[model samples]
Target: MRSLERHRDVAAYALGVLNEADAFRFEDHLMECPLCAARVTEFGPVSRQLMLYRRATPRAVHPLTGPGPRLLDRLLAEVALRRRAGRRRARYAVAASVVLAVAGPALAVLAGGGAGQPVRVEATDARSGVWARVTAEDRVWGGEVELRVKDAAGPRPCRLVAVGRDGTEETVTNWATPGRDARPHTLRGGTALHPDDVLRYEVRATNGETLVTLPGA
Candidate 1:
């Protein structure tokens, strides 16, 4: 298998998505590849983050009272069992220093909003009719694209369009409405596009001749 495919499989293994045979194959690869092993180690932190969130948001126990200590205790027990099973897996140790070296700069950039930039698009998913978020410097509207206004002075009507790299475009605006905050709006009866393949999104406002385009296209 190619290195990228192996890495993807490693991620899937870390995410607990691999079957037994694939898991064995990956384990054998991990023994000889220090870099792949290190990448696999990143999953430890990801798993911990998942666990923390799960603990913070326990399942509701009572209709009115919500989750209680009993639920937390059961969750803890499950986590402990999983940890014990993980201990039996092949130990491809990744140095703590290496993890810190790579994580420091990544964390800094993500904290600075350098990673949260939205992609602008000219169309919506032909199947799903949902547009990806677009970044704008000021209020503007054009074509099938609509701006996600934080708080407009009055009610704003918007339409979403999904466009693919294959030159396929789908536009939906039948149920669009304005809101006080920016929330994901969906266009019904449209197929969802793969994140990697989405070319752009188109946004347009009601009664306006202009259209807004976000970067994805």
Candidate 2:
């Protein structure tokens, strides 16, 4: 069993993939096994040279093995199609994740606010931008403030910052990028505010200098 394990380690060691513990174990076995020692010695020089020449090199051209024009054209077309499909899939995935991330908050805000409420602003797409509605609520003094905003267009960069009249501020929690669909955003936080102090919320898109500021609190 020990010999078998050591033999298995030989290939991994030769490829320089074994960790220190496995290398130590292999060395211990090599001290007592002459056949394994000889095998390691024979491969060691070749392995060292291979490691030394680790840089990748371009494939060398061979006259006899050169691909025919038709084969080359077909392969190129296949490669292009695969690359395009990969990009499309990546975009779809990003759109899906963004929608899922913001769907909950958007629904919550829509439910609490009236269906026809103008407080919620929806983005046309994720690549577009969104901002929450900033309004004065009775619970502001007790730190329960309700803010309605728009969802992000897509997986674009965005941030929400809220500032109170007294200079106290807090950020929205669990906020993420929006999906491809246009949706309203709602954020609620428990931060004490002065009775006369106005709260302000702003959404800034990071990709561009587009800024959306909500009405005063």
Candidate 3:
């Protein structure tokens, strides 16, 4: 995202309206931009304020007497609207993910070469009890790697890595999974590894700890 676009998203980001991918991108930006971080911090108190407003009982006062309660109600309405917008965005995001899941493979194969068939690779992490299945088609430039991960070690953030035959590591993407009671999460990324020149692909935490590996990667 461009600098100005990033700046403009602070409010939707604060309201939690961004999609998972966009939200993660904003957070990665927050780590480096103190200004944006500060804005998020300031916006943090909004929920508390809304809660306080909801708790306040309206005193029986005439319309001519005071507008304070009415103003507070307007503020409450705006907050509710923001929340609704966030929910709508989330629903749209889920729909888009489904569309991609169904359409992405055909598109990838078509992009690679209409005749190339897609391949599936299933992997497991015995130590952490995590598992993944990759559906991808190799291309000369770089190929699309789409897969879902299950049973993560914890809810912390992680990155998917592609390791080539010569041991070159490329970060395909980064994502987060629930710490517990987690459902399978889908992840999609493009790897620079040509199908013929790869060893294995891995999922790693931000700290560089390997989480899971795909065999014949």
Candidate No. with top TM-score: 3
Cα RMSD (angstroms) for every candidate in the order listed: 23.9, 26.7, 19.6
Expressed as tens digits, the lDDT of each residue in 76-105 for candidate 1 is: 787676555445431322344366678776
Error of 2 at 12 (Å): 38
Q: What TM-score do all the candidates reach, one by one?
A: 0.28, 0.33, 0.47
lDDT of 2 by residue, 1-217 (tens): 3678788676676455788787666656654555664454345445534432332222474433655669778867876775676578667766866887777755422222221121232222244345455543433122234555565355333444556676765433223344453566554443334223445555654333445665332
Model 2 CA deviation exceeding 4 Å by range: 1-131, 156-159, 166-168, 172-174, 205-210
Clashes of each: 33, 7, 0
- In lDDT terms, how accurate is model 3? 0.63
Which parts of model 1 are misplaced by more than 4 Å?
1-100, 103-157, 176-190, 206-210
Clashes of 1: 33
Instruction: Select the stronger candidate by lDDT from 1 and 3.
Output: 3
Better of 1 and 2 by lDDT: 2
Q: Sort all candidates by lDDT, best to worst.
A: 3, 2, 1
Model 2, residue 199: what's the lDDT? 51
Between candidates 2 and 3, which one is better according to lDDT? 3
